[model samples]
Target: MFQDEARFGRMVRIRRCWAPKPARPMVGNGYEREFLYVYGAVSSLQGQFDWMITHIMNTTHMSEFLAQVSSAHRRDFIVMVVDGASSHKAHDLVVPENMRLLRLPPYSPELNPQEHVWDELREKEFPNRVFNDLESVRRQLEDGLPRLAANRASIRSLTAWPWIVSINLNAH
Candidate 1:
C-alpha cells in the first residue's frame, strides 16, 4: 500500500467551474487557517483504501493509523510505501507486526498512488467550496471518505499505474 497524509482546511482552493452563458460564477473564499490531517493508504492491485481523519499529524497518530490498518488486514503482510515524514521515522513510532514501512525518495510525491486519491477527494468533495467552520470541513471529509472507499473499481482505475499492476502480477 502507498501511504500519505494531507491537510484539508477552511482555506478555499479556487478552481474553474461552469457558469451558464456569460454569467460569471462566484465562489466563496476564506482565509481561515484551521485544518485537519488525513492519513491515507491505498493498495493499487486490490483497490483497497484505508484512511483516518485526525486533529494533528505526529508519531502517535501515525502509529495509531498503522495499527488500524494492520488490524484490518490481519491475514496479509503489508509493506506500506510512505514518504520521509518525521512522524513516519520517529524513534518511538510503533510499527505493527504484520506491516513494514518503505520510504519513497525525497521530493517524489508523484510516485505515490495515494496522492491521486487525495486529488480525487479535493476535486469531488471540495471543489469551489468554502466551509464556515472547521467542523464543517470535518463533516465533509467524514461523509466523503467512506463514499470514496466503497468504490473499489474507481479506486483501482484511479491508482493502478502500469508499473504497480505489473509488479503485483509479477509477485504472484
Candidate 2:
C-alpha cells in the first residue's frame, strides 16, 4: 500500500465552473487556516484503501492509522510505502506485526500514488465551496471517501504506474 496525508479546511478556492463565453466574476466565500488531516493508503494491485480523519498529524495518529490498516488486512503481509515525514519516523511509532513501512526517498511525493487520492477528493468533493465548519468538512469527506474507494478502475488508473506494476509483478 502507498501511504500519504492530505489536509482540508475552511480555506476554499473557486475552481473552474461552467459559465457563458463571457464569464461573470467568480467569488469564493473566503478562507480560514483551521484544517483536518486525512491519512490514506492505497493498494496498487487491487485498488483497496484505508483512511482515517484526524485533528492532527502526529506520531500517535500515524500509529493509530497503521493499526487500523493492519487490522483491516491482518491476513496479508503489507509493505506500506510512505513519505519521510517526521511523524512516520518517530521513535514511538508502533508498526503492526503484519505490516512493514518503506520510506520513500526524501522529498519524493511523486513516487507515492496515494497523493492522487487527495487530488480526486478535493476536485470532486470540495471544489468551489466553503464548508460551514470542521464538522461539515468531515461530513463531506466521510461521504466521498467511500465513493472513491468503490471506484477501483479510477484508483488503478491513477495509482498503477509502470514502475509500481513492475515492483508488484516482481514481488510475486
Candidate 3:
C-alpha cells in the first residue's frame, strides 16, 4: 500500500470555466489559508483504502491514522510506502502490529501512487471552490473520500503502476 497526506483548504485555484466568449471571465473566490490534512492509504492490488481527516499533521495524528488503517486490515501485513515526512519518522511513532513503513527516497513524490489520489481529490472534488469554513471542507472530504474508495476501477487505474504490480508478483 502507498500512503500520504494532502492538505486541502480555502485556498482556491483558478481552474478552467465556461462562459460566453464576449462576456466577462469566470472568477474564483479569494484564497483563505485555513487547511485540513487528509491522511490516506491505497492498496493497489485490491483497490481498497482507508483515510482520516484532521486539523493537524504530526506524530500524534500520524499515529492515529496508522491505527485506523491497521485495524481495518488487521488480518494482513501491510508494507506501507510513504514519503519521508518528519512525522513519519518521528522518534516516538507507534506503528501498528500489522503494518510497517517504507520511506521513499527524498524528493520522490512521483514514486508514491497515493500522491495521485490527492491530485484527483483536489481536481475533481473541490476544484476552484472556497469553503465557508473548515467544517465545510471537512464535510466535503468526508463525502468525497468514500466515493473515491467505492470506485475500485478508478483507484486501480490511478494507482496500479507496472513496477508496483511486478513487485507484488515477485513477492508472492
- Which candidate wins on TM-score? 1
Model 3: per-residue Cα lDDT over 1-172, one tens digit each = 9999989898876677678878877566856889999999999988887899999999999999999999999988889888999999999999998888999999999999998888888878887787889899999999999999999899999998999888842335
Assess every candidate by TM-score. Answer: 0.96, 0.93, 0.93
Q: What are the clashing pairs of model 3? A: none
Per-residue lDDT of 15-115 in model 1, one digit per residue for the tens?
A: 88888998998888899999999999999988999999999999999999999999999999899999999999999999999898999999999999999
Runs in model 1 lying further than 4 Å from the true structure: 168-172
Candidate 1 TM-score, C-alpha based: 0.96
* lDDT agreement with native, every candidate: 0.94, 0.90, 0.89
* C-alpha lDDT (0 to 100) for residue 7 of candidate 1: 98
Better of 1 and 3 by TM-score: 1
Say which prediction, candidate 1 or candidate 2, comes out ahead on lDDT: 1
What TM value does model 3 have?
0.93
Backbone Cα, N, C clashes tallied per candidate: 0, 0, 0
After superposition, candidate 3 runs with Cα above 4 Å error: 20-25, 169-172
Residue-by-residue lDDT tens digits, candidate 2, 1-172: 9999999898886688888878786666856788999999999889887899999999999999999999999988899898999999999999999888999999889889999888988999988888778999899989999999999998999888988888743245
